[model samples]
Target: MRVEMEFLGSGTSSGIPTIGCDCRVCHSANPRNKRLRSSILFRVGEGEDERRLLVDVTPDVRMQALRANLSSVHGVLITHTHADHCHGLDDLRGLYWGGGRERLQLFAYPESLAQLRRAFGYLFDEDYDYKGIARFDTHVFEHEPFVVAGVAVTPIPVVHGNMRVAGFRVGDCAYITDTNEVPDTSIAKLKGVRLLILDALRRAPHPTHLSLGKALHIAQQVGVERVFFTHINHDLEHDQINAELPAWARLGHDMLRVAIEADGRISTDEGGGGVAPLAF
Candidate 1:
């Protein structure tokens, strides 16, 4: 099977070129240095039969969708309901308004869903006066792989400080963001994944997100040859970090498209470098 993953937003909560910051990465002219909040999109199949699953609904979702020319969002897979991750819940109403779906399909852990409901009460609340097509059919998933648009997505549970969140495995690629610890049980599920898009927040150790060294260690434990680190902070410069990494790894920037095959082959095209959609 072939799957394409697009990095809609690859930066941390505050994003790169953070406000009031005078860092070198912030001042850099390279497009790769620029980033939005963290989120990604998965694509499978083609034409009318195509399936798209969005992971996370970052605050930057509107801009991200416009940049990717996102056509349809068949489903949404949320890791957790942190402010940065789920703040775009309001922005996604437009998808339902414009698309053909009667109700948007969304999947997340039970607690994550609860948090989202509390945060965006009107979306799930039945008493609201606004009777719009922007409602959702929320599906709660646990450890098992759930089907989204004919694709089986396995939830890989990991710990972020004191809270539990999920990373997902779809086909040969696994996308995990906002994580610091992947327990042995969770790490076992990632053994055969050809491509891993993971969290590498900064150079220094963090309580919730993985540091550069720690993320690399986790990658080694999983034994994935090609890895794209996401949820980056301004501390690491794009080019300098890539130079320091092993050839199989690179710091993913906003709009990076990665293609992975079932047999472990991987190819990538930087968005600013060129147009990189295989099936779109």
Candidate 2:
């Protein structure tokens, strides 16, 4: 099966062009410099059998969905319960507006799920009698493989400071974010992935987020065919930083879309005919 992935938002928690901050990258003219909170959309299978799986429910999910022409989201795979990553849980009520009462499937780690339920108790309340609360069928998984909407998903355990989060692998692509380190066991799970979307906050080292240098090293160690860095900060200018990266790796931007085949081949709009440099 062929899987299509769309980068809904690629910015860090604060997002690019951050509030009231006047930095060079924040004031840059490049459209790629503008980013929303980190999130991604995955379309698996084809035709009617195709299922839309969202990676995170960022605060910008409403606008992101509208911009991407998203109609329905079948499931959501959360990385963690950070405000930037899952605060948009409320907006999912809109998706259930016209589609009847079909409950959406939500997959996450136990800790993350508990955080979400605590944060959004109203949405999960079965007897709240609320008319517009987002409805979901929640499922929890640790470092194991499970099926979601017929697509197999493997959770990759990663460490983000003192917190443990999950990254997911679907088909030939793996999406990992908000992490400073990937243990050897997790690296083994990602050994042969063709496409990797990783967290690369900035050039400077962070206690919880992967620095650009560390992200690059991880990409090289994994030896993936393509790498797109996400969870970016304002310290790096899109054009300048991207220009410095090798052809196999580049900074990921919102709205960027790529197609991956079952055999691990990847193609993007910027790459016509053959594999081209990662841009846009």
Candidate 3:
């Protein structure tokens, strides 16, 4: 079995350029630099069957999915109920409900489920016909192991100020976003992970996000063989920041992909032709 992950988006709350500020990285013509909020797609495959899982649905969800060429989404595991994490959920209607109307499955915490229901009652209201008209069923988490698409997922708990959010550990890869700190219990669950996708907003401290230094510290604590930092901001340029990280730690880019094998080992698929780096 091989599990693959694609970085759907890797920008902060407002994304790059801030909608008005003319920062160099934001204004740069590099398409890779053009980010669209934070999100990712996790896929597990065996032989010819592939199961796809999505994490977060920022306001840019529709465009992001289209750019990634992902036609169908199997499930969504929300990290938190923040607007940036759940706003684009309505777009799922296009995929979830088609000519026949099929509902999507959403896995989230109890509080997050409540917020989603309240904010988008039209999706829940049987009478209301959404512009696209999609339906979704919610599953509550208990910070324990659960199964999605036949893959076992262990929910790693992290604190966002006073609120608790779900960070998932699937196979040997853990994807955690919007987290400043992971408690001991969660840290225990993340041990020996081959690849860790962590929050590294910037170099400075933040109230609810892990700075570069803090993210590195947490990665060290988790002792993952290869750690990739996501949920970044324009402040951390991709090219310059890679030189600052350890050999096994790098800043994740907008389209970076990682593969985790059945034994929980991690690597990247370079389109089957490039030479892989040798360990020193």
Candidate 4:
């Protein structure tokens, strides 16, 4: 299956510029320097049958979609309940209503769904309606595999200290975010993937997120043909990191497009895909 994976956001939870800090990456002239929190969009099939699966609806989700010229969606797969990952979900209400209203399918673990319900009370509350628009369905995920719009998805469970988050293995492309360490069980779940997009929050150690070194170790251990680091911070400069990385590994930037062919061949291009940044 040919799938188009778009990086909606590649920045950390704080994002670039980080609200007043004067960092070089935050002030760089390169468009890739402007990033939102980590999120992605998976477009499968073509034409009318095309299915859009959102990895995480970050706070910048609306602008990200707007930047990429995406207006409709099929479902959402949340990694965790972090605000940066799920706050932008409210914007999806517009997608539910074009001429009329229609509910969309939402996939996540019980806890993540609970977080969504708690965070966005209006969507879950039947009594509340925003200009005659509101609807959604929740599919609780266990450790088992499932399908969303005909694409088989395997959930990989990783640890963020005491908490557990579900990373996804969609086709040959596996995406794991906000992870500090991947236990043996999670590693088993991630193995044999051709393209792995794992979290690398920064160069220094973080309490909850993986540093660049740890991320690289996990990528090497997974033994995937190619690896791309995401959830980046301003501490890791794009040019500096890319220059030191092995040919197979890359520091993912905003608007990066990763195409996985039916034969599991992985091809990615940030400059040639005509993919514009979702925001400035």
Candidate 5:
């Protein structure tokens, strides 16, 4: 079995080319510099029988889906409930109506789930009786492993400043974001990961997000075969930051796709809009 992953968006909360900024990276001619809020799509199985799993429904998810040609999503794995990460829940209604009529499965930590319910009360309100609302079969899990769509998913717990968030490990690949601290236990869980998609906010240190140095340390500690940094801010230009990284690591961009083989080998096919594949 192979798991194909796509970087639907790879920008920080503010996104690249941020509003009212005249920085070099924002004005760079490179298409890779243009980004949306962080999100990823995981495709398992093959051909018409494939199952699409989304990680983080950002406010840009609707546009992300359209850009990626995503027709339907079978499940969603939420890292946290931050406005940038989960505010696009309402957009799932279009997928429900146009593609899969069945309810989508949503996996999240208890804290994230609580926050989501609070933020989107109308969706969870059975008595509201509103039609055309997005629906999900919510499943709450802790820092444990669970199965979704026949794939084993292990939730790695990490600290995002004062709050706890989840990083998911499925097969040979792991996707982690919005985290500053990866405890020893979580590090142990990430051991031997073949492909790692991690949060690398910027060059400077942050209270709630991992800096480029911290992200590289974690990637080296885990000994991942290939690593891509996500949740990037405008401070780092795609080409400039990638030039500083080791051959095994690079800055991820929107629409970059990675193929994870069953034998733990990984290959990348960058989005064809002139962005090269981050060296494996």
Candidate 6:
């Protein structure tokens, strides 16, 4: 039951090299610093049975997909309905058609789905005309375990600002993004997880996102074998931060691939400039 998770984009809302900002990380020569909006794709299973679950379709999703050479997407899981997390959803029309599926399955909490319905009335509203638009068959889950394409997934509820969002645990890894706090109950749900991809917005604290110090604290509490910080802002330079971090943790970058084996072995590419899907 091993699975692989790929950091499609690791930057915060504005993304790296954000417009009009002349910060050092933004202009860093290292490609790792050139991050896009936060998102991840989980490859569950292998060969023909493989299912790729896309989490948080950011505004940069199109570019991220192209960079990763993702030939298809099996399903989409939204952490929340924030603009950066789900804005690029419409851009996935081409993927839906290209994958030759009748409709893409979308899994999210009730509140987020309601927001999606409002945002994309054309896609979900039965009253709207169905021209040639790609459809998303929405599935709702709330603080429970669900299955997608035969893989079991546990939803971990976390607080983001004034709202609650979901983080998912599939196999041995749990991904929590854009959340400043993970409740004690949710931490209990993530007990056996060996790998954690948690949000660490920047070196400084933010109201809604976890700061580096807090992220480290949570990772220690989770007692994960390894952790990679995501939802990064440009304040922390990639290489410099890694140099400062302990052996168990490092800042994640765009296109980073982490593979876990059934026996609990974990391996990574440091993004290795991203490897194309096997279909390529």
Give all candidate RMSDs, comma-separated: 3.2, 3.5, 4.9, 1.8, 3.2, 2.8
Model 3 TM-score on a 0 to 1 scale:
0.91
Worst 10-residue lDDT window for candidate 2 reads 271-280
lDDT of 6 at 196: 91
Candidate 5: tens digits of C-alpha lDDT, residues 1-280: 7887789888999888788889998887887988789989888778876878899999988788877878788888999988889999999887777555778789998878988899999988878887888777899999679988887889999999989989988777889999999999999999978899999999999999999999999999999988999999999898778888899998999888887866656879754542523211
Model 5 residue 64 lDDT? 84
- The per-candidate count of clashes, in order, stands at 0, 0, 0, 0, 0, 0
- Higher-lDDT candidate of 3 and 6: 6
* Residue range 1-280, candidate 6, lDDT tens digits: 6688899989899988789888898887777888788999999888888889999889988888888778678889999999999999888877787788568889999999999988988888666675567688899999779998788889999999999989999988989998989999989999989899999998888999999999999999989999999989989998889999999999998889887976768988874655323221
Error of 3 at 232 (Å): 0.7
* Model 3 C-alpha lDDT versus the unseen true structure: 0.80
Tens-place lDDT per residue, model 2, 144-169, is: 79998789999999999999889988
Q: Output the number of the lDDT-best candidate.
A: 6
Between prediction 5 and prediction 6, which has the larger lDDT? Answer: 6
- The positional error of residue 34 in candidate 2, measured at the CA in angstroms, is 0.5
lDDT value for model 6? 0.87
Off by over 4 Å in 5: 271-280
| List of clashing residue pairs for candidate 6 | none
For model 1, residues 178-244, the per-residue Cα lDDT tens digits are 9889999999999988789999999999999999999988988899878999999999999999999
Q: How far is candidate 2 from the true structure (C-alpha RMSD, Å)?
A: 3.5
State in Å the error of residue 26, model 2: 1.1
- Model 5 is weakest, by summed lDDT over 10 consecutive residues, at 271-280
Worst 10 residues of 3 by lDDT: 271-280
* Segments of candidate 3 deviating more than 4 angstroms: 97-100, 129-131, 262-265, 269-280
* Candidate 4 ranges beyond 4 A from true positions: 98-100, 274-279
Q: Candidate 1 clash total?
A: 0
Q: Which clashing pairs does model 4 show?
A: none
